[model samples]
Target: KREFITDDDSSDVTGAHVSKIESTIMVKTEASSVVLTQQQTSHLNHSQQSITTQQQQQQNVHIKQQPQQHNNIVQQAHPQQ
Candidate 1:
């Protein structure tokens, strides 16, 4: 099993503003599990149009899987809170 979390924050003076966001990701398999986490922050001044700031952080876990002897395989992406 694996677990992940992500947070996003954004602000704009004249446009849409996203105050905060949170997300989590997880992956599990018969052989291994993986997890990922990410965070991002951004600020924009629409009046100036030239001033902008952004920050991002990410964390990931990697699991090595053995070569599959069978040809049957599947992949999927699912959102989980």
Candidate 2:
């Protein structure tokens, strides 16, 4: 007497994997600015005046109205004794 045993099997497997990534960037800047302005104005005026004067005077006068007279007399006598 002989005995025989036989086994037959079939297997199937399916799998799926997915991955996503995101990136960000940054930038920096520095700057300086300046402005200046100036203005000036001036004015001047002058005036002057002068005056002078001088004077001189002189006078002389004379007058005469009159008359003058003069007289002289002489007498002599002699006696003998």
Candidate 3:
């Protein structure tokens, strides 16, 4: 038997319409903010770019608290797991 499979999952948003977010963060003693912009690279394709950026932010944020009962429920939501 000969069979093949194709996984097709993409958005209706066109390449010309969709905006890519490439942010630069400024870490200071007082506060921190990111400058959001659309950036393009030569080597990486859209699929690779999308996969990398999807999980990028979750790696940077970790909340340390007293206990589960006293902790903020809103902040406890896991995006990666």
- lDDT (CA) per prediction: 0.19, 0.10, 0.30
Candidates in order, TM-scores: namely 0.12, 0.07, 0.18
TM-score of 1: 0.12
lDDT of 3: 0.30
* Candidate 2 error regions (>4 Å): 1-63, 70-81
lDDT of 3 by residue, 1-81 (tens): 122222222343443234432122222211121112112321232334345543333322321223335334424554326
Show the colliding residue pairs in model 2. Answer: none
Q: Which regions of candidate 1 are displaced past 4 Å? A: 1-11, 14-16, 19-59, 64-81
Model 1 lDDT at residue 42: 15
Q: Pick the candidate with the highest TM-score.
A: 3
**What does the lDDT come to for candidate 1?**
0.19
**Model 2 lDDT, residue 70, Cα:** 11
lDDT per residue, candidate 2, 1-81, as tens digits?
122222211111111111111111110000000000100110000001001100000000000111111101100111210
Worst 10 residues of 3 by lDDT: 29-38
